[model samples]
Target: MKNISLRAGRFLTLGLVLTGLGLGSCKKDDTTTVYGNWTQDASISAPRSESVSFVINNVAYVGTGRNPAALSTNNVYGDFYALDPSKTGSGWSSVTPMPAAAGVRYGAAAFAINNKGYVCGGYGYVGTSTNITYLSDVWEFDPATSTGSTVGSWRKVANSLPTPLSGAVAGSIGNVGFVGCGFDGTGNTNIFYQFDGTTWRTLTNTYPGQPRSGAMSFVVNNQLYVVGGTNNNVATTDVYAYSTTSGWALKHYLRNVSNSTESYDYSAVSRSLGVGFTVNDKGYIAVGGSTLTTCYEYNYADDTWTLKNPFNGSARNNAVAFGIGNYGYVGLGYTGATRLNDFYRFAPNDAQQ
Candidate 1:
């Protein structure tokens, strides 16, 4: 009987150890994968904000905007740069800059279709004549023919936005591209417009989104998600999603839950002009005004936000971001008095939680 009791105890011990190992394996498999940190990358040649960026044929291109050092003091660049993420050490290559007549300025909207890129709108100031000029011209850049280090060529599109826009956002879905919500000189407009390679048609669908500028847009699963920006001097947490099925509807609120009553608290510092980009099906937004550094991830399927890794870079606003393959590149923006030029690449890892 004593021998039998010892054998039973050993069996129990083995059973417990096996069960613990099985539970550990279950935890590892059950945990939802979170993303990783932002790895610093080669910096762009110039630090800027209110600029525009788009991807075509797996290459990312950025250009046009006033530099922080010269903003309001007199200086805006039409300079363009291109980067191949697969070859990060090669850095950003200088493309042909925008011409004077093109009005290559900040706050403009940009998108890519069929391996070509289009840039339109933005506030223009050349040499301190305080009159404030907004642009409605449109130009298309094609890098398909360029060989080696040579940049692309640009030709003016036949059609342009009927109303001049600044601080607008642009994105592409399928074969067409769309532009929306910009400051049209007098005030903010909520009009939605799309371009089909040649013609520009304004969609009459009234986007209930606050008519404000500095908002940013990103694409995930062929849908466009527009996030926070200022509307009528008040910053907002209103987040909207637009697609063919629903023209435009509020998706998820960009706020945290309040301890009291467990209600959605809309009072987070407004994340206007923050950088936004997508990795896989998840969209990540971070580092805008109000000295914000907390990054939030939006799950479109569930409409819930989960905290991801905070931007490991300096806190800033009015930054620009674009994704290539699975990685998102964020860089160049204003930090109150200073403008930042540091660029970083983000990759989501499963253990980020």
Candidate 2:
């Protein structure tokens, strides 16, 4: 499920300077209050984009994406890492890499369930520019059973997804994990599936939004919210929610629509491949396709979005994000053909300094 690649914009450095330091008369500068503060954290081991990430037992595991610098060789990453937000003093440590047999790939979907993390369904090049393979194989990573150097082990799941997919979004609610909506080689799809850590079952209902790929999914209040993605080559704004008990229903549109009262622009929220995570009962989407640093917060109670301070990092897409405790972590993405290793911790409710 490759995006209809948007051209990367050129990098420009901007600086702010305070004028009239010694002015005889001066006016007090107005203090503007802003929500959300991003603090830089440990960088990932390497720079890559379109990676997959999941959290298990408060530890984030990230791996498997394309490295822009390795394009000529068509090398995709299989190396994985683990970072515990409570113990960031140790930084990120390498976990066991994904199996070589799975074939290095990008645009995969990941979710954690039953204390284990699972990666499934992505597409990869087959040693040639013209040859691409869509994947349906599923792999599970168990950190508790790991050996030295935090090296976890992976095992292939017997029942993979029914069809090959890429650019899908995944999340787990209580004991059940859900995956849905991505390209299935021919075109984008709205199909969805659920796994109880063993067998896979197709959901009786498909996603109700436009068929999409590269959307963002995050769980808040035990409900799965699927928002923003490309449909028919254009970024979509529709937002949808699903719960095991209630099935699927359309939520507020990401843009300022008939339902919203806030005047702040939400057009920036319409994007694909952005990072989405929940913090302090609210959900945030940041850094995505067409290259943006803007971050938006979703309030499920009111079905509204509030713009936060822009991401402290450079504008990017295909970044990976995970929420632990009260903070959300975002990092490792592509900015203007440049793969980034820098990471940041965002406090969406904090006052920006």
Candidate 3:
């Protein structure tokens, strides 16, 4: 062989190229997969949705939902249950009910503030007729005492929004709670309001997604994400986010898939229903209808949507979900013509890629 001279920089460049290609190949082989499906952690003796759920100190408390009639009359259930996922024994046990039966309401909202849970808004039978009364009232529940008292009842706080509205999405970041985008009985709304324990103030800026009702919302990394809901039962895949300074920005559109079957009908016949929770800066949405057993997740860093494993329970919609640390709980809803009172939990290994 003839004598060959090699440049030092050229040799380093060749080494880097080979290393990069090898890493890229490894990443390409790492396909995303669903690790955990739904598991029956604890079954409530009674089932309810359109009710409220919140977690404090790794314990989940669920209460309130409509009865089987699909009518608000006799729909209110005051009884509550406490679930300890860490325990191996019977998961959920009965706790105190609300002092009085809450309004016969469905599609209400709930959040925890100062270790206390607050429940607000939903349809109820104030009279004999079904009315979309958005409750301005708020109730406080203490997990330590295992009791709830209506302390922060719907008082007119400073700069309160127009009229009481229901089907609105509510969530909290830090000490502030946000309520945005829903119906006022007659029409969809794009208004945004914030509550700081004592008062409510409307943000001048509004979200970009089409005004909708029954959408699900959660906060991660101090940013709020709102996903999937209906405009007259017209489900939408549009997702939006709000930050401290950046009011609202369109993130991505959710897509539905059936075991690798992809579809872009986010606004198809699916009903604008409820079921969402936050996990490790990501938000997961579960169960909504006109159809059931559907699930999806939103990644905040990339602003991308990924269809996850479908719920393994009865296919249904109009249910609610809450996250306690890494565990997710889903329960209660109308499954086509019938109403269901069952609940399930989803646990995924956060360490695995």
Q: TM-score: which candidate is best?
A: 2
Give the Cα error of residue 114 in candidate 2, in Å. Answer: 0.3
The C-alpha stretches of model 1 lying farther than 4 A from their native spots are 1-34, 69-74, 125-132, 147-149, 256-270, 350-353
Residues 64-158 of candidate 1: C-alpha lDDT, one tens digit per residue: 87776555624576789998978848999888766555754788899999889999888875333445588787888998755345678887899
Residue 19, candidate 1: C-alpha displacement in angstroms? 25
Per-residue lDDT of model 3, residues 105-181, tens digit only: 55556677677666665556443445636555555666566234422122223343444567788888877777778
- Ranking by TM-score, best first? 2, 1, 3
What are the Cα lDDT values of the candidates? 0.75, 0.82, 0.65
Please provide, for model 2 over 137-160, each residue's C-alpha lDDT reduced to its tens digit, 9 standing for 90 to 100.
899999888755567888889999
- Taking every candidate in turn, the Cα RMSD to the unseen true structure, in Å, is 10.0, 9.2, 10.0
TM-score of 2: 0.86
* Cα-lDDT of candidate 2: 0.82
Residue-pair clashes per candidate, as listed? 3, 0, 0
TM-score for each prediction? 0.83, 0.86, 0.77
Poorest lDDT segment (10 consecutive residues) of candidate 2: 1-10
Where does candidate 3 have its weakest 10-residue lDDT segment?
Answer: 1-10
